[model samples]
Target: MAFRLTPQDTSFFSLFATSAGLLVDATRELTRLLEVQPSERNAVAERLRTLEHECDEATHELINKVNSSFITPFDREDIHNLAANLDDCMDHIEETADLIVLYRIGEFPSGMAEQFEILSRMSEITAEAMPRLRGLKDLPAYWIEINRLENQADKLHRKMLAELFNNSTDDAVHVIKMKGIIDGFENAADSFEKVAHTIEGIAVKES
Candidate 1:
């Protein structure tokens, strides 16, 4: 293991883990929303809103901790960026759910279910990577898997857009609404990769 310049307030790792766990929960909620009754989606979206707020709080705590502590587990900038990226991921997840509820989107397109599955896998991989930050062990696998998932998401994203624009019979307004939701999912996946990139950088620097 590489030397970790941690403080007594090593709670940053715990906070990071908690934030990632919230992200996992949020993704699961989205998966459920995709499968459940249309009428039940709004309530599921509300749960996502609550989870997002909690994630925001966790990110804020990480920021405050970074500000107060003279020593951090990694570079202060890396910590802040990682925290922000995690929060951004959760934000996009929440926004996707919100749009579904707000737009009264009837059925989640079958293509989007695949996107949600990718998001869930990304979130799970990220949560697993969070604790590994303390030791910087076996992290290459984490980032590699994240990159693979992001690529899969990109392929799905392109297919969804192609299907929506070319073959769908839905009205322009409805297609536009779905485009926004798809954008959110794509953005969320990108954010996870960003976090992975940040961790990869920090690990290289620390090593």
Candidate 2:
């Protein structure tokens, strides 16, 4: 039998997919922010801020639809959780970019490139998966890859922390700045994993 969604659910899926695309844009901006001049960082962050705002609006629309709809494509609770989780991912992505500008961090740690790389990959995986939620077909690969990336991110995060505290002779001030930036990156990675988990749960129940 084919899967079917009420028209409202289809609209929700479309909005969710749009938010996922925004996340991809945010991740790309983050990577670009890492490579650019310090003076240009603020401008890049501003663009991310705009994307984040759009994601926020999409999330609100999803929640409002859930509240108003008498029937949902999947479990209403799952729908709510998925929407919130996706927004959380976007929140962390925006926070990572905003903090970079606020802290005026000078050097990008070697480990940071790896973290953002994983984030970029996760965003692509997530953007792809959101639309697939409609049919719940062949989605195991999406969540599985996200889980693997989350594990990879954890290892890199630990390595970054070890380098941050162990090898640096910098003053307490520098440590504080770098720590904030690294924490943001770690949070973003963690949030992406949460998104994957929520999607997997929905897929499992539907299948």
Candidate 3:
């Protein structure tokens, strides 16, 4: 049987997906902003502020939805965890963007784009995982693939951090900047894993 979303759940999740989509767009925008000429640094900084506000508002609304609803499509704990995980993702992204703006980072690193690319893919995967909550029992197969993405994310995060520490100069600025970037990407991966964990929890209950 096809699982359906309640009107409330549908509204809540639509906002969730929308926020994730905005995060992807913001990531790309930040990438482009960093590539621009030094003279335009102020504009990129302003854009970061705007994106941060949007992310914060979206996250808070999602939390409110989780709190106010007496009934959820899944377990209350699962829903609460899901909301927190999603917020964590946005939090990391926004934090990193602010760091970039504060530093007025004029030059783009070569491999940073690749991490963002993987993160975007993972974001879409997480969104796909959300609607499946309503139909958890029907989709045992999904858990495997979702878990696969989580593994990929973990591997990529480790590799990226290793490269960051290995190849980058020993300057404190470089270390801090690279670590911030790596942490944001890694945390996004962790956020996706949290979603998987919620689904797994639901699966366990059903079984």
Candidate 4:
């Protein structure tokens, strides 16, 4: 545990928690993309876009707070990295939803729901972990679970790609579009892991 001689700004934790909570909301909207009719997908994408923008605002606020504050809970660089990575997670989720709408994808692959489910779990755990940054307690488990989930995402991604490519009926264009969406989800999952890794690094440095 790290001891601070001066009082550190604890609001950073609140901001981080808010940012992570938005990620959960964004992932939920992403999952809704799977449920809504194609005609209604645009609305869902728009909602995701809104969530992404809110995330951006939260990140910007965190950075601004960092710049102005004399004392922070952790290193400024780590704070910036963590905020950027959280934003990246939301960005990827929004981009994936946009692609689904832009590509006019009528049906999803079999494992897509599973992919979204993983991301949802990642976001949920991430939100849960943010408040713990105050003490940096019990953080290893958070990052460890994120790593495990990311591995699951990678394997599922490979399986999705193989299945997509193996399908003879899907046109080349269709395969390409599907690949883009799958890759986007994988990227989002990777972004979550990046957040976890950043948190882990902070824990190490502060411990």
For residue 108, model 1's alpha carbon misses the true position, in angstroms, by: 1.8
Candidate 3 versus the native: TM-score? Answer: 0.74
* TM-score per model over all chains: 0.96, 0.95, 0.74, 0.98
TM-score of 4: 0.98
What lDDT is reached at residue 27 by model 3? Answer: 60
Ten-residue segment with the worst summed lDDT in candidate 1? 1-10
lDDT of 1: 0.91
Model 4 steric clash pairs: none
Candidate 4 per-residue C-alpha lDDT over 70-180 given as tens digits, one digit per residue, 9 for 90 to 100: 888888999999999999999999998899999999989989999999999999999999989999999999999999999999999999999998874888898899999
Better of 1 and 2 by TM-score: 1
Whole-model lDDT values for every prediction: 0.91, 0.87, 0.66, 0.94
Q: What is the lDDT of residue 138 in candidate 1?
A: 90
lDDT of 4 at 64: 99
Could you tally the backbone clashes for each prediction? 0, 0, 0, 0
**Stronger candidate by lDDT (2 vs 4):** 4
What is the lDDT, from 0 to 100, of the residue 34 in candidate 2? 70
